[model samples]
Target: MELQKTILKDCFILKPNVFKDERGLFYETYNQNVFEKTTGLKVDFVQDNQSVSSKGTLRGLHFQNGEMAQAKLVRVVRGSVMDVVIDIRKNSETFGKSFSIVLDDVEHLQLFVPRGFAHGFITLSQQSIFSYKCDNYYDKASESGIIYNDATLGLDWHLPEEEFIISEKDLELPTFEEAVS
Candidate 1:
């Protein structure tokens, strides 16, 4: 396994060793010992979540607050996306900064988003299957999100107006300032 460090503190892109032959291919997604050793991160994922979305579908700028905060290991299974993570940790030097990566089935790359960050992705392919492992159980009361298109953050989702798709619920999320407050 290869753990590629990202600019964001404590975030990483994990590349697995893939063995391919004339017949097919094989790779190990997660191995406790290997994961802990390579990334130096000791997280015990309690829940696995998967979602399917079409091109231009923008999902979040979401996170769990306080004790319910979750660290996530995210990957794409069937297509591609421009995945983004924003450091929202109050005391961190990189707070309000963001990192973006192109994760797809072909590359089989995974992103590790530590707790205290807002995680989101916009499907770049016709459709995509996004899956993630959360270190903590999800609690609805603790769920919170920042507006995905907040001008202050200046995120480039790389989609045109007609193609962009988002939910009303996500639209109601607070702006970055409101969220930080």
Candidate 2:
């Protein structure tokens, strides 16, 4: 596997070395020793989660605050998605900045999203299975997020507005400025 750094601080894109034969294909998704060696950060992912969504389904721009903040290792298990993250660390130079990438099963790419960021994704295929490992357990009171269409952030979903299928809860999230305040 190879680690590629993103513009955001402490974030990375991991490209697995896939071996394909006439029979099938294989690759190591995660190895603690190799991860520690490549990224120089030893993280213990305590929870694993997966979600299945259809095309145009958008989730997130979400995160946990304070001590409940989580660092996520996210990837597409089946199909594809346009994954996005925003750095919200007040002290970091990249704070409030966003980064996006197309993650698909074919590429077998994984994104390491550090704590102090908000994350979300839009399914780009007919059906998508999104999987992730979180370093921290979830706390309802600590949950927070920014609205996906906040004018300040100016995020381009790359799909027509009418095509989006967002939950009422997510549509009611605070704006980028409100979230960090």
Candidate 3:
């Protein structure tokens, strides 16, 4: 696996070596040894979650606060998506900065987002199946989110605002400034 670091410190893009033939392809999506070597952080994943969404559907800009914050390894198993992560750690130098990548079945790339970052994605194909492993289990009480279209952040989701479909809960999320205050 080849790990490329993102601008936001510990975040990374993991590209696995794929061996293929007419039969199909094979690759190790995650290996603990490689992960520890690459990031220097040992993670114990406790939960795996999957979601399916249609094109133009936006899922996040979500995070967990306090002790419930989760570190995630995300990938697309079917179709494609434009995955995004925003650095939300209050004391970090890159706070408020965002990183994005196109994850598709063909490339088979996985994104590693550490705790203290907010994550979200937009489906780009007819239907997308997204999966992720989290270092921490879900805690509804600690769940929090920022508006996907928070103007102050000026995230270029690679889609027009009107073209995107977001949940009412997401729409009601606070802006960055509001969140900070």
Q: Which one wins on lDDT?
A: 2
Lowest-scoring 10 consecutive residues by lDDT in candidate 2? 152-161
Candidate 1 per-residue lDDT, tens place, 7-66, comes to 999999999999999998889888889999998778999999999999999999899999
Candidate 2 lDDT over residue span 61-141, tens digit each: 999999999999999999999999999999999999999999999999999999999999999899999999999999999
Q: With candidate 2 superimposed using the best TM-score fit, by how many Å does residue 154's alpha carbon deviate from the native?
A: 1.3
TM value for model 2? 0.98
Per-model TM-score, in order, reads: 0.98, 0.98, 0.96
lDDT by residue for model 3 (49-135), tens: 999998899998999999999999999999999999999988999998999999999999999999999999999998999999999
Give stretches of model 1 more than 4 Å off.
Answer: none
What C-alpha RMSD separates each model from the true structure?
Answer: 0.8, 0.7, 1.1
lDDT of each: 0.93, 0.95, 0.91
Scored against the true structure, residue 122 in model 3 reaches a CA lDDT of: 96
Look at candidate 3 and give me any clashing residue pairs.
none
Q: Model 3, 3: alpha-carbon shift in Å?
A: 0.9
Find the number of clashing residue pairs for candidate 3: 0
